[model samples]
Target chain A: MSSERSARSRHRAILVLTGLGLAAAAILATLDHFTHEPIALERERRALAALTAVLPADSFDNELVTDFIEIGIDGLAMPARIYRARLAGQPVAAVYDVTTDRGYSGSIRLLAAIDPDATLIAVRVLEHRETPGLGDRIEVERSNWIRQFSGRSLDDPPRQRWAPDRRDGDFDTLSNATITAGAVIEAVRRNLEHFEVLGESVWSDPEDTEHD
Target chain B: MKPEHQDIWRQGLWQANPGLVQLLGLCPLLAVSTSTINGLALGLATIAVLVCSNAAVSVLRGQLRPEIRIPAFVIIIATTVTVVDLTLQAWFHDLSRALGIFVPLIVTNCTILARAEAFASRQPLVPAIHDGLAQGTGFAAVLIVLGASRELFGHGTLLADADRLFGPAAADWTIQLLPESWEMLLAILPPGAFIALGLLVALRQWLIGQTGALRARAGQSEAAA
Candidate 1:
């Protein structure tokens, strides 16, 4: 009831509050510390899995091609990275440095895989933000625009390849997704060439003595 | 206080669903609802974080200085989220990957933040935990329903990857409804998520209205008698 007692109560309230705040913060931080790696590793695992699905992780102990080459794109004015798919000192597949810069929407990054014999192994769209229903038909979940590139090859040996079905050729373009189809086809075309030209360096195992 | 707390649960389910009513988490809800399992996985993770953080905040509501409460709340949220995220990875690695950034991103989700700031900051620990559980369950319900709607129509079945979301026993829970060839191209896309959510919200509203009308009719009859 007195001033001194009221002041003491206020201080008690403040102390209790502070203790609670500190306790909550401590619990959260502990949780954060423990979960951080698994969350990150989970992301890495999924990304790695996607990559493995496209490029065989089991085949190459290297798990990567350090040499990053750039190739002038057919449809776009930009040059994208060229990666080689290697398996124990031999070129197993050509991982193209593929990009769809001129789609009906924004730029789309893709890795189109073609084996040493030049059969399409897989097409992985690295990035794209097309309309979810219409233009996003580019995604594997939507239209089959990607799978169409599976068996495609370049008769020109990495310089110029098969014409996109939309431009009146063999590969079929998405019914209403002509521009997307063309851009993907072009990225695939260039990607295969990067594999051919850079195959030896990209796919060959570093331990091999023949290069020296 | 009692009525307000009750409203919190009611609000999470119908009046203020995180996915449909508030439109907070359209990204993952659209990106991953290829199956019901994906929906259930995300919903459960969210519930875990919500209950933990909300309870922590409620317990500490009095001590946090007014000047530093926001940062304190965030630190708490991030921590609880981190723990839940880690637990998922260690125990449910496949699901942890499937939900991806959305789990950690739950730290930033407005639904959790709004509750921490509005309900947990002012309430006692017991009520706060109750609010958190109610809200979390509500949000999860919406996500699961939205997810199930898409998965069922998209794949011509429900619970396609039941084992992934609900363990191996649920593997047989998938209901094969349509002939495998019939795919509703519209139902599986992002637009489908929106359409599904819109229909879901409408369905919830209809159910709520029916319940309310029945209650009102009973009350009037009792008064007249």
Candidate 2:
């Protein structure tokens, strides 16, 4: 009789546990249903904000976020998205969203905007895993280190001089963060080189890649 | 408040602090306390989860059997944490991004599970809710203190990214304590968290010891009189 009672209690425990699991699932599903759209919108807003930060608002009449193309470059770890900015029908600049795995900790993602003349408009660090106090000076919010990239081009830095001064290059590196500074400088330099290769052809519609 | 409720507050806030006394949920405590704003954000999320989980556990205490109570509590806690995580992502998008994985990882904070199993599972709904609030505040206080200290010493500022947690109006809320060029790198690193926590724990212990000595002296004088 006791054994039978024990079996029944065990059965009841399983039922209750399962019921709790189901109830929790229902709550989560309801939350996700409501939050799904707002989350997507938030992400889009952040991405658009990053794009606009690099591309001057007055210089571009077109929607830079929608006007983007995907291209695989030698320096980037993965295929990069290049956003084209135009004043009316004329191309103003192209912003390359690039990633490099050469950071001290892990990956570093950046947005590099280059004018039609191949001169860098600006650069911003989107995401990075570098040490906070040491390497995070790359962030515009943290320091003015990244702003040094503006108005620079491959020819001006003379190709080889486009590196941290620690590595015998022209650009100044953040104190105690040479690796992070080097990774960002190299990524920007490679982006400019790739932009030079793509030239005015980069302004072509993203959907017309098959023709090339 | 009732005597029992006061007792719960005393235990949760001081006698049984999850951060200093019990030392529960130290993973998120250490990891996200790099900055004051990050700590505040995580602490708020933790408080939300803790209250909800405690309330649920207390409500279901009668129905939950001994054998399956652990699993039931886990489900309740996980669900509450996910709800918080999703809400943060939707509304407080920047704070959520700043917090990153630590927000979702609240399910494994251990303090929630400890409270659910030990106090909430045996207590009534009102007391359980009180316990949650008191304990959550205690933990958050520790986090803010640790974060502010680290930010001040490590990066030479307090609330450096106030806008991340408090929206754009707080963009200028950061207080620059030290000069921009000055930085104590070790304070921002992982080792700094351990040292700071140790000092806080020691401070609490010393205060307790002093109070105990004072109370004993007063008792002796009263007896003599």
Candidate 3:
């Protein structure tokens, strides 16, 4: 009789704990649903605000998001998303991240902006904390090391032909920040070539880029 | 608070620092510390949950029998963390999303349950609250320091999204250390996070050593006198 009583009590304890846990989750889910929308709105507002810093407000009338498959470019192979901003019914700029594995510390994230004509416009350091006075030279403000790629044409930077001035190429490397600069140079090169191939898809009707 | 009760509070901050000494909650600590704003935001959310859970456990401690206490504590922590997670989702939204599933994962944070088991289950309300505050504050401080260090070296600025934590008034707080063209690209990578955190740990150890030396010297002088 005593053993049976103890077993019964243990079962009751389990049942009580389970009920409480379920109740807690249900209450949380309800609260989550109620507050989800406003939080999403704030996020959209922040993202839009960030764009103004990269592209002039008047420069774009629409933002098209799409997943485009990118083939081999400067030895990189992968698919990436492209955000096409159209102005006055013509393609103006494509904003995307250019990832490269050559920073003095580790991987680097570079934001590349290109014109509709498939030419590079600006390359900005979106994320990185490379060593100061070394890999930090990737940002244009740190030095003019990146400006050399601004006006260079496709013919000037042939297939896999673009490299740091050290390897004998159109792009010059940053003083002491060579590996980081070299990685970025090739990243821009690959990005330009990748965009050239996807030009037609990007120039497709603006409504097509929005992904579900 | 009781005299012994105060010691529980102090222990959470030093002897059992959640982020550092205990190393209990680390997934969010590493993922969100990319920028100071992200680190500060998540840290605040974690602290809110800790305080609520600790108090709730204390309030209900008397009703729970010894054999069933652990289950009761787990259920209580889960409930509080879930509530806190949902609140942030509804109110802060972007932070909730950027933090993503990690917010919900707080239910599994060992520190929360550990505190409940060690202090809240046996202590009174006020002291339990103090323990949570001290622990949460220590966790937040470590996160903010990590975030700022990572942001400054990796992104060439401090508090890249200051407004995320404080409000729009904080938008102007972002510091411009180097020009847009010269910032290094490696500081934001995961490896840099590891290296930077390692350096921070080393710095902490050095500080501990200095403090220990000072205490020992004082002890010798007092004995001689």
Error of 1 at B78 (Å): 3.9
lDDT of each: 0.69, 0.88, 0.70
Worst 10 residues of 1 chain B by lDDT: B216-225
**TM-score attained by model 3:** 0.65
Best by lDDT: 2
Q: Model 2, B1-225: lDDT tens per residue?
A: 333877677667777788997899999999889999888888888999999999999999998998888889888988998999999999988888889899889998999999999889998899899989988988898899999888888888888889988879999998988897778888889999999999999987778678976556434533432
- Please report, as a residue range, the 10-residue window in candidate 2 chain B with the lowest summed lDDT: B216-225
lDDT at B207 for candidate 3?
Answer: 67
Candidate that would win on TM-score: 2
TM-score per candidate, chains pooled: 0.69, 0.92, 0.65
DockQ of all candidates, in order? 0.26, 0.77, 0.28
DockQ measured for candidate 2: 0.77
Sliding window of 10 residues with minimal summed lDDT for model 3 chain A: A64-73
- Each candidate's fnat, listed in order, reads 0.32, 0.97, 0.57
Restricted to chain B, the TM-score per model reads 0.85, 0.92, 0.85
> Weakest 10 consecutive residues, lDDT, candidate 2 chain A?
A203-212
